[model samples]
Target: MEDYYVHPTSIVDAGASIGRGTKIWHFCHIQSGAKIGDGCSFGQNINVANNVVIGNGVKVQNNVSLYEGVELEDYVFCGPSMVFTNDLTPRARYPKGHMGYKKTLVRHDATIGANATVVCGHTLGEFCTIAAGAVVTKDVLPHALMAGVPARQIGWVCKCGQVLDKNLHCPDCGTQYLFVDEKAGICKCGGGE
Candidate 1:
């Protein structure tokens, strides 16, 4: 028996692989060669393009598309209407096809907020938070809290999604983090270990 649930209006192509207990909701289209991991939830009007890989426990909200060359790691959250580009430059007349697509990787436990636009070729680091309406054009650091157009790292965040203080401690969760450098850090209290 099939392990996943696809809404009646959704179409999961024959070669697509959906893991156990995943739920694909209304108007979703999962193209051939897509691999979706266990317990993922995809909301309405979503598209999973060929070869897109979505990991376990991910949550993709309405109107999002996982295009070719985009990968979501485990427990990532994609908010409603978020955009992900696969090409740096796109022309209707001169299509680059799949060969020209650039990869955008959202690492484990990251959260991309509503209406956010993630340009191709960037990696959103683990536990990073992209605030609503932000435009991400470059790589994000782990635990960074990014906001604004052409997103900048305004602060750090905890694995539990709380903004961290300057001392790298989460007030909401009381988890401590240690900075390895200006751009990298790790949780000291085993929150994201």
Candidate 2:
């Protein structure tokens, strides 16, 4: 029951769990059974459905809806107006409840840009970046930069949010990645040099 901020205009259900320092802004609705971690921010018009779990330091921008079966790991960034689909097939006549909803996982430090659409049943790897307006149809590899329709891996990115150079180094933050194996993939260097 640590202190948190929920705007007067927002409605947080009785059984929802909000961690310390989290803020739910105007017009947001947090349903019962939702778990939000510390220092997270949910902007205006957001919806946190029942059974949803959001990890610490996550920043969810305006107009985002987190449906059931969706899990966001720590330090995840959900941009403005992004869409998350829980059901792949929809028939208004045939309704699929929470039991039918597909699970979606956004790993730690991932950035899903504004207006992006993440289809259900996919895992967005840690530190992956999904570009604005792109539609993610499959699992994204860690540190990969995805763009275009159906989202292809255009290049690799650094944890600092910069596209990695030819040497697999971050130009902005000085983070370096050492190529371990072509199959096993690159690993982040221990300390910034």
Candidate 3:
């Protein structure tokens, strides 16, 4: 038997690599050249496009599409119906293939909320949280709590997925953080304990 589990209704194309202990649920399609790491779980109606790299322990909710040129690091969470756009400017008449696709990177331990739309060619730093229904049009710093259209940083977040207080401390985990710059911060509690 294969290491991973693909549901009877799901389609895993030849040449797609699904790591050990991964589970692909019903109606999911994993295209050729897609690399899904170990211990990942993909919900129903999900599409993983060619050349996409998804790291270990990633959780992709239902109706999500991971397009080409999108890379999700380990422990990333993609909420239900979250959208990823690979083309900066898409047109039906003019088709830009791989060359025209822009890369979108979501770093480790990030959470992309439900219905969030992430425009390509930007990087979401580690431990960042994109709020539900947000439109992310730019790079998001590490540990940032992003929300609203165009996804502005409303505040910082702890690695435990809790919003940090003004003192840069997490109420839930009691983790401490220090400002690195205007757009970024570092977890003082041993790398976001």
Candidate 4:
């Protein structure tokens, strides 16, 4: 008995692993070797390529394609038509398969807005926000708000996805932030450890 629900038009290959409570809606395809976590919701016209791994509680909106080498950590949000690429270069005659694919890691709680294109081999940090239509060409910092064609960090965002002021405070959630190292990102002030 399957614990997850896949719509009649969607196809889950034999070797795919879909966790309990996942809902794959219309016209989606989960290729072999793809692993989807529990509580994930994939909307219409989606594709989960081989070896792609999606973490738990992730919400991917309509028309998204998660290509191979793409890994979405827990609680990630992919808005409508967000594009994730695997290969940096391509040639129709000389196609490089998985060997040429570059890995992309989207850290926990990050939100990629609609129509954004995430280039291959970049790591999107935890809690980062990529605005719609932005093209990310580099690794993003945690809590950073990125926008524009070549997606540059415009500001920082709170864990609740609200923009932060220069004082590093969240207006919406009333959370204050203290800067940590590049690896640790931001920490709650007064040591909300």
For every model shown, the clashing-pair count is 0, 0, 0, 0
lDDT, candidate 3, 119-166, per-residue tens: 999999999999999999999999999999988989998888999899
RMSD of each: 1.7, 1.5, 1.4, 1.7
In Å, residue 134's CA in model 1 sits off its true spot by: 0.1
Question: Which pairs of residues clash in candidate 2, taking residues 3 or more apart in a chain or in different chains?
Answer: none
lDDT-superior candidate, 2 or 4 = 4
Predicted candidate 1 versus true structure: per-residue lDDT over 48-155, tens digit per residue: 999999999999999999999999999999999999999998999999999999999999999999999999999999999999999999999888899999899899
For residues 15-50, write the lDDT of model 4, one tens digit per residue: 999999999999999999999999999999999999
Alpha carbon RMSD to native, model 1: 1.7
Residue 167, model 3: lDDT of 86
Question: Which 10-residue span in candidate 3 carries the lowest summed lDDT?
Answer: 184-193
Estimate every model's Cα lDDT from 0 to 1. 0.94, 0.93, 0.94, 0.94
* Best by the TM-score measure: 3
TM-score of 4: 0.95
Model 1 quality (TM-score): 0.96
